[model samples]
Target: MDKSLILNRLKNIKNFATDTELANFLNISRSTLSNWYARNSIDYDLLFSKCENNVDINWLLTGNGYNVKNESNVLAEPIESSRKTKDPIYELQRVPVFNLEATMGLVPLVDGNGVDEEKVIDYISIPSMPSCDGAIYASGDSMYPLLKSGDMIAYKRIAVERAQIFFGEMYIVAVKLDDFSTMKTVKFVHQSELGDEYIRLVSHNQHHTPKDVKLSQIAAIGLVRASIRLHN
Candidate 1:
């Protein structure tokens, strides 16, 4: 596959945006954009869905495919059944995982597998795992000694019942920045003896120092119930 052709197509169809500008618009960094420049081809469905319609998938993927929206119609649930189930109650659903790779430089998973979200495999339902909105496969040795890259960590969303908790507790937290969401393991946020509030997070590895994040920036929190690491 000719990647330069796709890049050239992207440049021509970029609507006055530079490559970096186009990448950021697609919620991907410049480096990631550069990395894809060498690929022979790409899965248009997955890539375009993540890009959120900023670029023409057909043109960016297959050089000859036209830029057109593909739509399909499907049958809806029975009207009578839908009407009867008006008072729907939602239990804690599948875990929500933020993309750390394309969006950030976190762990990368198998892309374009087209896995079904509804396919609840028994492997994902271990009783030892904590109840969470979802699980995230950890990346990097930043949390080494405790968590390794590709370890599946279970998490529970922070809520009223979970707020006002004490320090030293291990939790999965989404750190919201001015432009991005960073996921990290949090130990606790507390006020020092001087009355200054500090967010303190620990590193499992001895080489890395503990980090202090501001309390005001914690977007969401979830308790870490269990983690499963791969042997190989």
Candidate 2:
């Protein structure tokens, strides 16, 4: 699809007056939208699902039909009926969810030439989260209220060279200690008094104290993008 055409359609939608508004309407980040524009590739299925009955699919796909559904078609439906419908499976992307406790052993399989698809214990479908390579179940209360145990966190892999951590952002980092590997949130990163770089792992629960870790101990890093919590 033409990038300009998609952007124009999005801009014309009601309440999507700004890029940020459009991103929110689509349930994605502004950076994700920027990346789409950069690649000139928009996930049209996701766009259509989000727009639902508000947009004319034919027009959206070919630019040859009315922008909105016909008035008669709208009136034919019961006024009390909800316009929302479940998105088709094809429109949703499935991501593998790995067990945090077992991820250390799984890392070698993932870092190999091919990921061992069998290592994935389960899959979660997310229609709105963008650029997620996989997900991990939050293990401890380290992130507490922000990310509780059992919450599924969508993440995107960070290249070794580009693994620089943003000071305040939450990240799923795999650290290699002398005896074992573990995943934890890197809450802060800064230089020490002697100028050596260090990262602070913080827990939202006040009972847990923050620990400093060296960059060299990190084996892999994934930027936490979106999270889902299941409520009883």
Candidate 3:
């Protein structure tokens, strides 16, 4: 394997789990996981399957920051930049659908667990990413103007970013400190007087109080990308 790929694989390992958790997830038993670490390298396939779709393999290997070409590359046009069909009225028929679940309480419109190919829902094929386990449904108005109750939100599992505060981007975050609940909203992370960092998960709606938390407390973070409102 190239030196860059090796590095990227290691970076992905860092995101998958704590050392112990990774060991458990791989079913390697602690001793074996330790052995692999001690050897300074791991099997390519073993590390590859463990990564979430959002992880940039190129970045992992050589710091190129290149995202893997999503599965859409083979069967469909590029997302976001796909051209509209010449015949606007020609709509695609029902596509296979999956029932997804939002383990976190905030976004409720997401499809939760279960896919029945015979029962197609909509035809918009979403390219799965390493981070994207499935879609989430919006549950509350906490993310009002940007997202509302019943709106389906696309979520991608991502490595937790502790230092950056993406002002407008919405995220599905597990606050490791306060109840460890997952909430969907805009967030900001700042420092406190005691040399600690605070995370503020906010709602666009003015009346809702922002959730303020400490950095050492976060468990996971998922970046929100797009959503589809089912209108009759």
Candidate 4:
């Protein structure tokens, strides 16, 4: 795709005050944008990440769908007669939400041992969800509009030994460092050219650079099953 087309589309949608503001919003330097324009090449991944939720990914990439998302008409739930009964209480599974700080602190404890549920700060009941071991509140803009800060993500725990990473899927991975641990999304997993195993972490917001983490640093992993976004 031509980078100029994407730049024009972005300009039309945002109508930013200036090019500097647009560059800041996209988290790219002016030189980088100029380079992309000169080469007529689009960084699809970065563009998609920056325009997530607001713009239709299909339209942006292939020009096959509506430019903007129509959230209301997208997934209207079917009305069931049972829902009109006197008692409308639905069965739900309660998943514990752990404190982000404590969850990171507990990464080292997962050296073959399971997560300590004692660190959980609270619990929430969700209906129509698959079996989830725990939940965590998102912390950074790395995931941007699709998963803004404070969004709840339910995940099923995966044993370290039996963990099989699904490339291009989202995951909550705990990385063990010398004195602390951190959590991020796993974008892709593959062996390096030198035959060393590594996993790439990507942010939905393009400003954050993708990181390649060695397999040795991974302490625990969870397969993300569902996400609950609480809008203000």
Which candidate has the highest lDDT of all?
A: 4
Candidate 3 accuracy as lDDT: 0.47
TM-scores of all models? Answer: 0.44, 0.52, 0.50, 0.51
lDDT of 4: 0.59
Instruction: List ranges where model 4 is wrong by over 4 Å.
Output: 1-91, 103-117, 161-163, 183-196
Could you tell me which 10 consecutive residues in candidate 4 have the lowest summed lDDT?
A: 71-80
Each model's number of backbone clashes?
Answer: 2, 0, 26, 0
- Across 1-232, the per-residue lDDT of candidate 3 in tens digits comes to 4442353244333444245655665556777766665676665576556554544455455433333334221242223324442111112111232233333332222122123333324434444322233355577776677677778765544445443335446776665424645434433333344443666666678778776666556666656655778776
Give the per-residue lDDT of model 1 (tens digit) for 110-223: 121212234322234443222334466777786776887888876544421222334666676666665665555534333333333445666667677777766555655555
All candidates: CA RMSD in angstroms? 15.6, 13.5, 9.0, 18.7
- Candidate 4 residue lDDT tens string, 134-161: 6888887877866888888877554432
As a whole number from 0 to 100, the lDDT of residue 136 in candidate 1 is: 68
lDDT of 1: 0.47
Error of 1 at 204 (Å): 2.2
lDDT of 2 at 105: 25
lDDT of all predictions: 0.47, 0.58, 0.47, 0.59
Say which prediction, candidate 1 or candidate 2, comes out ahead on TM-score.
Answer: 2
Point to the candidate with the largest TM-score: 2
Candidate 2 lDDT by residue in tens digits, 34-125: 88878898887888787676566765565443445652111121122233521112224556777556555224122112235666777777
